[model samples]
Target: MKFLKNKITGITIVLIVILVALSPWIIWHFKPDRHLDVLVFDKTVPQNNYREHKGFIWLLNSFKYTKLNGDKYGLLDYFGFFPEPNYKYKIKPLPKDLSKYDLLYVTDTYGVYDRDFYGTSKNIEGERSQKIYGGTQSSEISSIKSALENSNKSKTLIVEFNSLASPTDTKVQKEMDQLLGLKWSGWIGREFKTLNKNNEEIPRWVFRNYRKQYGKEWNFTGSGYVFVKNDDTLMILEKRKDTTKDMTFKFSPKGQEDFGIKREVGYYYWFDIMEKVNNTESIADYTFFLTESGKDKFKKFGIPTSFPAITESKIKNHITYYFSGDYADKGEFPVVYQAVGLPKINSLLISDYGNTDSFFWKIYAPVMQKILDNTYEKKSSETKTASIN
Candidate 1:
């Protein structure tokens, strides 16, 4: 009887140990971490109203391969503030005890809360707020500024959606200038109100007209120029009106040299002429423009345009070109775009966070990988110095 009792006790102890060891994985199976603490401040819960919610969920699930284990990861919804461990609560003032978190993310809806209270311990601030069109309440630029200033512990990455409201009204421009001055790495999200979805022939005609006036091909090469810096590459597509006002020469006849002909030039007229010449709808086209520096960088890499074409070399390098719309549709795992407003924001989050040879591991892994690597490197350097001494 004594022997049987001891055997039962041992089995129970073994089972408990196994359960403890597997607890983290078990909990993670239900709610996995994307190596990020997404604090959604939007008034909508589960972001059901926004189309991007599906894409967001998809993005979250794509990280399952990483299978990172930890309690440090979760989502906080800041609509009606309450601390619910099961459902990441949205608290008004960020908790002072954020030492445990490595990254913090803020989305739309929460722009009204006091950001200064969050105390900036985050490494990334993904801002997708744009000016409220019609009658919507736009995200506050001051809040973005406060969040950036407070997050002094590490570099803060801002993902601004479209044009920030005029700098005169808000301090967003000032904060942006400061960030640029600090040499922080960042990118801007430019959204186009209209897209060219007509047949290829129409696009070709538009291209031809653009080339005749600009002395460049209107295809990928011309379009690519907008993202290129120098080389007189005007890749950006301006509205026909804007382009005519900026690029065309007005004709006037006051002297014999000018002939007896005078013509008033309007921007759209040039586009109309092009369309007539090409037998197409309208010649006026719009395109997103990158900063001069960004364009120059693209030129150096031979990546001239934003069109989605993956070359063999790029594929070898594991570089993938993602179109804004395509990314919104397919990038997220479970499709969160339906819940979040994917159409409203034109942005992409590119990081080697999930890549096998990720930038994060390249930059931070050596610090802890085999303490001997650090020890040996330190000893070897010290020895060389000693020899010199």
Candidate 2:
């Protein structure tokens, strides 16, 4: 009897040990909140109403993205503020403690809160109180500055949907300018079209190609864009800011540096262009923001500067990837004209996201991932080493 009793006691002890060994893995695999925290700024795009922008969704649905018991265990399981734990109540201000997260994403353009805050003002009672209003307060910008400043311990990435509105609140714009070393000017319109192959849009850049079946083909050749930088990646759609070198170019059917390949039928329509921030002089030290064309057109509009859509910035352990243009809003905008909202299509301005994919994203996302995946500092022993090489 004593031997049998001892055997039972031994089995119980072994069972408890097994449970203890397996508990963490089980909890993390089945419940992500058990071990992850994240701070995300998901202010609405004000235009992507259908939720067609799948950039965030793609990361979430990825296979083994949140797997535990392996290297993938520490992936972005607790995304910005939404995965409310089983019984935790949602609140306005972020939790006082954010040392637990591995990544912080401030991914939006205009700080739209309760429509009334910006855009078409509306009265959505309950929703307005909850949002971080555009220009909520200088304190909010201070918070973001503090987070990025203090993020020496984690990988921090902030993507401004509309780079112009890094911090939409006017109150915070000054703080943001200091934090990013860049300032919002105004939207620069690009003149490009979606690559509509047959009935399907491939969701990628189709180079400088369009159809002129509806209007005079020669007038719509999109003649102004000249090769400033030989970067084939960003050189696709033309209509770069007017440049002195652009006065003379061999006219071609294909509309490239070389002439006479084939007549590429296209259109000359205005687009919502994003320009480099105001601190063009300081930007060269960090990331060389895009280049301005023949002249600073925005100066006439009060922006005082203009540049193409390309940018990169790094601050201490916190690195920011800026997409000067809003890729989500496909390069499509019917306007009176880019200068002063002249008018296009009609006297009214029409806005829409073209197809399944945005041409800007095709080139921007991969490059951005390459830049953000690595840590970079200013004038360091590693600065000479390329981030992607």
Candidate 3:
């Protein structure tokens, strides 16, 4: 009897250990695959590198959203990055009938540039990616409009930064702007940790363009913010002179509740300054903690100290979200997404202060999850109502 009892105790311990070890995967499986008919359009794909939409793809996998192609997650559904024998780089045409898709997520329309294709390190295009497969094509814009119209205002469209920026024809851009009720300021800016050329963070074209325009050498050094207009106008805000602190991305009360964001997060990346038009609501904004000097400089250039980071507009039944920053551009966290608790652990281990991925985990992930969840529930409810009718 004693020997049998001891064996039972050992077996119980082993079983508990196994269960604990498999908990993350088990937890992951319990979450239902929402099976959303999502269409992700990322045109910036160069080679097999999926940096532009990597984080978004991971979210799709995490949410278990079935793409329009019937697969859980695959590059096949993307309108861009399709390589062929004749053309190694070119954005594949979008489908004309997009009404079938429940969600149209445009992560990066910036497209593959010459530098991106050949690689920046090679100096092939002299720092200019030079729009190759980027910018919103007329056909693509038309399809998006068709989708919105055909869906009877039920479709959701989410467009991220650089979608309406330079390289995209003004006429084509105006179509989207008019449709979505947004006005692009024709300027994009980003923060730099250092202006030292040795760091190699500053793009070569920036220096070249600055020199060409001003006919002077690049002399400024140290951390700063750089802004460039569509017409090639360049302005720099050095750290001590312009900004007292780094920018913070904050969500409005409505946004905080809607997106389930707990608090503000550090924002360090490319962001465009935009003015809301046609009753568009600013859901979130980037607050640049600028010095008096910085304020004057921005004012002189007709730039606002604080600009909309995320904007939302509702057209009839259709809802649109414009993320004025490169929101979806981030490194993929494979293991972090696989396990349930890994994200929390990872967040605790790393400092969110300067880290870019922290924003993905803290702000982007939860918000995206909420969007997917709400959309799934709403769609499911509509289906049930339709069946009953």
Candidate 4:
């Protein structure tokens, strides 16, 4: 009788221990839908290199909730955290219910993978040496296109094709062109000077005109050959003007604005630029911030006075935003990391884990936060999404 009683107590204690161990997962599984369901289509990131890709991975990690172990990730932690975005990282096939997720992030490396992005993958190759993948997989681009098409909430789709090298797959390029309301004109190599903020002449590409965040302004000047042509559905809400005062702020480039916000970003000296096209509008543009000699050289190439640097458009109820460059490059990430307050999480990955801010908070984590803040608004529940079959 004593032996049997002891055995029953031991089993009960073991069962209680197991239940306690699994409680967090159980609570999450049956929990009410309070958090945003964010889906990251992350196949665009290449595995094998750890250092270069660390910044990108750090960005993704910022969206995640860390687990108790702190050093390793369990199954529950792998899916993501609660309260804000319960991010489910999907790489291969698109999820079945297209409308289920609140936000979709496609890295859109096109075909060329960044050597820096290769950095993190190299560090992760201890288990399987042969399984390391570098470039985007086949059919993945088509799958993303299909997802966008099938999703009525396509506006929630956040994508940036970071590569200047056009997709060798013409089909991918064509689909992106039609979808973005601009035709990809390939790459360019040049230098960009700081926008003349105090000159009283508002440069066509000055994007820092937004009211301000935390009572401050920020802008980037990078040379990437990203050219685009507008389609029939284009909307140039505000055409390129020499200078104009819109929204109370006057056009005073040199003497008018804070000096800290206006700086040059000249990586990928030769990059891609775009022209406005169908069903789209240009909100930001490239400035002629060149020296007389540089201007003469650019003119010889027959480049236009200015081109749209930022643009937006709607397709099938989804609103997609496009930019000329990415914030993941080596030159830009450090500054962004400092601005975002994670100064140590760059070039090298930091293992210290904790809960990160929401998407709205972290979205500004990159250089484009200002642009997004002024342009894209959070979608209300009442906002209508297209019905996809």
Candidate 3's TM-score? 0.90
Please tell me which predicted candidate would have the highest lDDT against the true structure: 3
Candidate 4: which stretches are off by over 4 Å? 1-34, 42-97, 110-142, 145-154, 188-271, 330-380, 383-389
Candidate 1 lDDT tens digits, 236-290: 4433322222222122122112222122211111010000111111111222234
**How many clashes (backbone N, Cα, C below 3 Å) per candidate?**
33, 11, 4, 54
Local accuracy by lDDT, each model: 0.28, 0.36, 0.79, 0.39
lDDT of 3 by residue, 1-389 (tens): 99999999999999999999999889887875667888889887765657777788877886677755556786556877654443365556778889788788898887766665665433442377466667888888888887887675266889888789877899988888887788888899988888876656677888889999889999887888889999999989998788887888989877877876657778888999888887998888888888898988888889988888888888667788888888788755665465665555556675667868777777777777777777787788788888899
Order of candidate numbers by TM-score, starting with the best: 3, 4, 2, 1
**TM-score of each model, in listed order:** 0.29, 0.43, 0.90, 0.46
Which one wins by lDDT: 1 or 4? 4
Candidate 4: C-alpha RMSD after superposition:
17.1
Q: Which stretches of candidate 2 lie over 4 Å from their true place?
A: 1-38, 45-53, 60-64, 67-96, 109-137, 163-167, 187-299, 302-310, 328-361, 375-389
Rank list by lDDT: 3, 4, 2, 1
Error of 2 at 72 (Å): 9.8
